[model samples]
Target: MSDDANGRRPSIRDVARLANVSYQTVSRVLNDHPSVRPETRDRVNQVMAELNYRPNQAARALVTSRSQTIGILAASSSMYGPASSIAAIEAAARLRGYWVSTANIDASDPGSIPEGLAHLRAQSIEGLVVIAPQVRVVRALAAQALDIPYVTLQSTDLDVDHMLSVDQVAGARMATKHLISLGHRGIYHLAGPQDWIEAEARMRGFLEELGASDVPTTAPILGDWTADFGYYAGRELLRVRDFTAVFSSNDQMALGFIHAARDEGLDVPRDLSVIGFDDIPEAAHFWPPLTTVRQDFAELGRRCVELLLGPADGLESPSPSTIAPELIVRGSTAPAA
Candidate 1:
């Protein structure tokens, strides 16, 4: 039994001795080398079972030239996009037999993204995935030297080797077009920060829908994609007194809009119609229940991994892709008042 300085006991040597085999034989069995006979493997397995031998992670990494780890640099917390995307990537990576280590970055700061990337590279990470949904992050990636195999989530920039995003434009179109179909002519939008790629795409989709239809377009109200911003924007909606239906950039903003509508003594779906994007879990439980566009962030993560591992021959073909958001019709949206 080899006890480390910390007094942990029972190393591979102890297992080999107990199994009546040389340490080299035990190494072969542990490393899945084919030289070991099945009977010897069975005996080693019995010894390992009895002694509870575990290999050191660092030693294994050195031998195989692989860390068996993936690095993820992501925003600490902004909304469902960053948080949900990280969770999805972690889960999918684990399923592929890789461990995930994450570094949190400030969503608004370009420097934070690269700083996190530096930390990950220092760890000798084999691959890097960035969950940067904002424009700052996009620009940071373009300017930095990301030499490792890299993938970006929630950004549409094809300049990167691999990229994936929820079809934000399509989602916005779904949200706005849905409102238009409900007979509302005066529709308003609470857009997310202009610096975020998703926000820009969503805003574009909303405007394109209005432009394509007979209904007129009002400038989208800017919001920061927070419940408070939504709430405050909701309050502003009361003063405008012109638009009958409002489409918010995300569910958090939608929640604020809902609260603002309630506080202003207006009935949902009766006096005003409201819809949102992201279709968050709580969206269905709002006062009148929300009708919004639902995006599959988990699917997006899986797709990112696939794209990162995809064949590199098709460099010029349609590499850019989009995942469309599904519209969930709920009680919050109704025929215009």
Candidate 2:
């Protein structure tokens, strides 16, 4: 309740003096040590609050050798999938009473991977979550030989013990099968950039399903996972009027493709059926309400936290590393006319 005459920030000693406890007791309370009595802990917390004492996380980490922080080394963080995963991880980490520090890296620059890792490590992060969606980024990460527990959000068959992700291949297959069931033999796939892991997996699944069902397959068009690309590609592809349906890599592109369809005086599902992946928040609001594949990004984030920091308070067992994606059918497609 008293202000320091020097007008300096309150320190742990000040908190201990005000709380009538030893300096060690304040440290234990800061660390959440179980040995501290409940009443004493409450009293010290009250004093800390009254003094507005903020613990220096860096100092605490050096002394305790446990930062109680998780680091996210992310590449291509601006993209929807990676960005969503980052948000999910941060939320999950907060639920577990830990802080999150993120270091965004240019995935194209191999040199930046180590620099990003070093920056996070300097904070003494106890665990790491990697949002590397490119094969090259994953490869660059694997070379680091990190000493702490880490989890990668993409499935690359490398360090399976540390990998967690939604099953992209299966999700794509679900999309393709949905179209095939609708009696659309001529289907085109608008895939993500060739190097992206999710894009490749989805394209693979699309081709696999078409081959299995005897539906003739055409070479997929590689896209940059943008609405602009989708609109342009759709304008070009629709000129030929070859395929009855198109499965876009993500909802953004699907939105663009639908726009192009409208421009060309075509009615969706009546003349052309379109589907997309990721089931972004806007997907359901798209004109005609796009039908798309949904990945449980929340679950993926929770699992990443669990994999790195152990299951949350009451979780007795860890969830599987690979989450299955769900097929969300909306108004985007109907029986092929």
Candidate 3:
């Protein structure tokens, strides 16, 4: 039986005719209806496979009113943290047999938030994951009054019940404490953009640690979370060279800062100790490998899916809501000279 005997793609009716079963029977099999006999279901499935029949997901969704899809509302998605979280959520959603729909919006524009939500809601997503890392974005999302189960990846304290995040403040504190333990009092912080919630939390952690240790605080230099900014900041900051160590918000900036340091004839961890966040793939390969903080992005993704859809079968219950960040000590940091 050819799929295009009449010059049209094969339909469920084609499978039914070839398997000698009713179209209703094929529909039951497609839905895993238990009333269909095992032998009959097997035959229909075999015919479907033979004819390369694929059910129209949109049509099925219309009939059942369940799209089996999740939506991601993202802003600043090009950055490493948001980008990684989105990828993780997609991978986890796929494992659970759900399709993912993403709607990217401008974090700076409040109007784009509702527009993005409306676009995803039209697809009938069963759940939503909000990857808005900015404070204003989260606040804008809250005003929309979304009805579906939703999880926000950033910890803004705006929606504690719906937030899942790595403890950014604690992670920053860990990085700061590591430098302090090494006897470095003259430390400077390279923070992400001021609007980012993670950046704010990290800066808070750094400040809190400095206060606890009685180390005089220096205002953090805000950057756009790029190596280019890090390079320029490094060049300007190094002109005075008052600080003995620097803690960057992310690894890319750390890499750039290191480059600038080298350009100025400063050896990393010898002239200045450096540490970064995210421990990006290239962190380990930097000239003197980057000592940085690591967030379990994969685990974070799995948890986001589980939170919105519940735990997967045969798997343990979801771990704690806040994933702890790990400090990976490497060659970039050392005791201040």
TM-score of each: 0.78, 0.82, 0.81
Runs of candidate 1 exceeding 4 Å displacement: 1-60, 76-78, 158-161, 309-320
Best candidate according to lDDT? 3
> Considering only N, C-alpha and C atoms within 3 Å, which residue pairs clash in candidate 3?
none
lDDT of each residue in 119-140, candidate 3, tens digit only: 6765668999999989898888
Backbone clashes per model, in order? 1, 0, 0
Score candidate 2 by TM-score against the native.
0.82
Between candidates 2 and 3, the TM-score winner: 2
Q: Write the per-residue lDDT of candidate 1 for residues 37-154, one digit (tens) a residue.
A: 9999999988887766666653466788887778888864457878888788777777667778888888767656656665565455778887777777677778876777777776
lDDT, each prediction: 0.79, 0.89, 0.89
Error of 3 at 266 (Å): 0.9
User: What is the lDDT for 86 in model 2?
Assistant: 92
lDDT of 2 by residue, 20-49 (tens): 997667876775655689999999999988
